[model samples]
Every structure is written in structure tokens, then in C-alpha cells.
Target: MISTTVAAVVTRFAPSPTGQLHAGHAFSAIRAHDFARERGGRFLLRIEDIDPGRSRAVFVKGIEDDLRWLGLGWDGEVVHQSARFEAYRGALGALGSAGLLYPCFCTRADIAQAASAPHGPEGLFYPGTCRALDPAVRERRMESEPHAWRIAMDKAVEQTGRLHWHDEETGEVTADPLRFGDVVLARKDAPASYHLAVTVDDAWQRVTDVVRGADLFEATHIHRLLQALLGLPTPRYHHHPLLTDAGGERLAKRRGSESLANLRENGADPAALAEALRRGEMPAL
Candidate 1:
């Protein structure tokens, strides 16, 4: 059993630098900071810039500006995911050596077509096209192809008797791989997926707790599996409620609604903004 009274709860605010910060982002950042401050712990800021195509320096600067404007302070220098590709590669190589990583060659169209044929999720549930290749065939493919990397769930399940984690807010958590199946570890284009990047970053930073929006509750399973596979300590998760718009849709930076920048432009008070989000008020975008 994990200890309840954390000696030092290290939390983090990891935001992708692909877009601007919105009310939801502010709420989560403040909540994480407050949680760490309340426990006399460390609050970290990490840049989730794995998506090199979309992540930009301007957006990163925007994030720092926004967080500072919200009166949030972090403990150390901000960590960027793009600079940690070698670490991700090392982890992937470990998984590969353990026979727990496999290359996926299925394209978006192929996955989509497969999914449509099976009437499943938007994309193919990874038909395991490259999973069962013979050693020689796999070697030949690896020699000639560029493919995404996927965790071999069967091997992971065999290694770890059961997958489970403790959420700080939700309590005891468990997941069955039979339901979620294998998840991608790295894309061919994007070296690190969100799950892989987050798990590695948390472990690297010695984060003891994670506080984010409730929308990612299901992703806890993926993180749990990654932690077990990588032999990294699991942090307590606290998933807070999401801030939504008046239309009841979740606010997104890409959608250009209820962004902190816009709120500030409209002369919205930071204190009042925080209170409004806490009270679930749809801020005027």
C-alpha cells in the first residue's frame, strides 16, 4: 500500500506548446499548484512538445506568460519533451530488447478502413498486422520500413500480474488490458506519444502526484501500463472537473474560446476568473 501522507508531493503542469492556454488549462494549473503548495510540495512546469510539427517556441513563450499572469510559480526550470527524444529512444530500446515493443506499419487510411470494416472506433484497433510476423519477416520489414512502435500488451500483462494505480481523488483504480488492448508507444512521425512522454517525464522529474482534468481519467490505464513496463514509480493522480463553455462543450485552445489571453483582453480579473471557473461559470470568451 502507498503512503497517504506524502513526504513531498511533486506535481506538474505539463501543457502541449501546440496552442494557447485556456480557462481549462488555468484551472488545472492553479489546482495542481494549490495542491502542491497545500502539502508543502514541489510544483513543476513541463513542456509537452513531442509533436514537433505543431509545437512552437512562440506557443511555449505564450504558456509561460499565461502561467505567470495567473500568479503560478513552479519549482524548477521548465522541461521540454523535444529535448528528451534520446531518453524516449532508450526506453523504447529497452522495451524492444524485452520483446515488449513491436513496429506498427498500419497507415491512418488503412486503420480507418479496417475500423470501418469492423465498425469500431474511428481508427483501426491495430489489427496486429505486424505483430505476428516471423523473425525473418520482421527483420526484413524493420530493415526496409518506417513504422510506429506499439507496446506488446500480451508480454506486459504476462510480466505484470495485474495493472492498477491509486488515484489521489478517485481512489483505487484498475484496468483490464483485454478491454483497452495494446497502445502505441511512439509514432513513426512523432517519436513519443503522449503516454510514453508523460510517464517518462514524471519519473524523470520524481513527480509524486499528478493533477489534471477529469477528461483524461481513462488514460490512467495507459500510464499505469507504461509505469509497470518502464519500472517507474506511479504517482498519485488527481483529475479535476473540466471547464466548459456555455454550450456545454469543453473549452479548447484550438477552438479559440475562453482563452486566458482573450479573458485578459476583455479586462477579466484573475481572481474573479479563478473563482468563476471554480463555480463552473462560462466565462465570456
Candidate 2:
């Protein structure tokens, strides 16, 4: 049994092994490490390599080396999402048995065409195409064809209460379900989507806190709802500011942004790099 020690605040740095760790990644890692140390807590490393198309072993190794060079260490063995596919599938099966999930046959173009009206964020919102389908009809379609699985938002909203999380930096907690509805739990290509993977991993690792970027603040509501639906404990959140490039755009691996490796290659000091990240400055690459 895990000890209920308030002295130990468990946190995790879950990075996708799709690309190199950039400045923003460093900033979030250092912040999580610092928070854990400050409260005498535990910091864990989790590789979110569920994306089979982009995730590579080389990138995962590079992330490990980069974090080590940054003078950051995590507790216990690193957990990889790819190895935990069974757990995600089990969770999905549980939800499906409860009639909370349905197979969605609508494609991107189909959703866009349905919402010929206006939408927000990514694009046209996901119409409840599959929500109204009878169980027999859905089962027939599932046996005859392939489709992505999506959670039923109306049922989720009715069964679960409002979703909310405390933001450490902002010191303000927010809750809004309308902003997030019927999020995809699994894709056609990958059985598990990020929402399911993250929730399952956090629960398995006993993460008490999650430290990530401010950009994911809104998405926390979706996660919280999933946690509630799965009957898992919700972790505290700390969404820190992001590091941007000279063009004022967010730093990304594909953009050739300053990475921990590039800084180390230039003989940059780890302590200095950590300090620069805290000050929101791009370390010398």
C-alpha cells in the first residue's frame, strides 16, 4: 500500500518521445523538480510514447540524457506509456461496459461538413453523430467496420460533476465542462489517446501533482472529468509559463529551438541553464 505521507508530494514529468527536449520542456521539468524538492516530494519521469508514428527510441534516449545533463533526477524506474497499452484498453473496456463510450464513425471532413456553421479552437466541434446510435446498430457497425471511440459528453456531464483544478501559479481554480465535451479517448490508429494514457499513467504512478505549461490549463478540465469518471484521485496542477522564441512564438522541437543538448554541446553550465530557464531566457545553444 502507498503511504499517505503529506511530506511526499508526488509529481511527474511526462514527455513525449517524438522530438528533442526544447527550452520549454526544460522549464517545465525544472519547475516540477523544484516543487518536489521544495516539499520533500517525489519526482517521476514518464515517457508518453503512445504516438507510434512519431515516437522513437532514439528520441526517448535523448530526453533521458538531456534531463540528466540538466542535473535533474527522478525517483524509481521510468514508465513508458507504450508498455501500458493493456491498462488503457482495460480502462476503455470498463467505460464501454458502463455505456459511457461509443464508436464514432465521423471523419474530420464529416464533422466539418456537419458544422458548416462556426466553431472554436481546433476546428468544427465534434457533432454527437454516434451518441444517438442504438447499441445493436453500433455493435453491427463495429463488427463490420473500423471506427474511433469517443466518450459520450452528455452522459459524462450528467454522471460526473463539474471539473476543476487548482493552478499553482495563477492561484485560481477554474471549472468549465462546456469548453470540453466528448473528447476522444482512443483513435483509430492508436487504441489510447492522450487523455486516457495520461490519466492511467498518473494513477498508476500515484502522481499527486502535475506540472506542465499554461497552454494545457484548459485541457485540465477534460482530464479531471476523466479522473472522476474512472474513479481515480485528482492531482494538484502547476501550469507554468512557456518559453518562446525571438519571433514570440512558442518554442518547438521542429523549429530547431535551443535544446538542452545544443546548450551542453556549447559547453554551457547546467546550473546556469536552469537559472536561465527560471528567468524565461533561452539558454545559449
lDDT of 2 by residue, 124-223 (tens): 6676878778989988999877798988877887888766677778765655655556778998878899988998888778888899998887777778
Number of residue pairs clashing in candidate 1, backbone atoms closer than 3 angstroms, sequence gap of 3 or more or interchain: 0
- For model 2, the stretches where C-alpha displacement exceeds 4 angstroms are 1-7, 116-118, 121-123, 134-136, 172-174
Model 1: worst 10 consecutive residues (lDDT sum): 115-124
User: lDDT at 67 for candidate 2?
Assistant: 90
What are the TM-scores, per candidate, against the unseen true structure?
0.91, 0.91
Number of colliding residue pairs in model 2: 0
User: What is candidate 2's local distance difference test score?
Assistant: 0.82
Provide the overall lDDT of each model, using Cα atoms, as 2-decimal numbers.
0.80, 0.82
| Candidate 1 Cα deviation (angstroms), residue 200 | 1.0
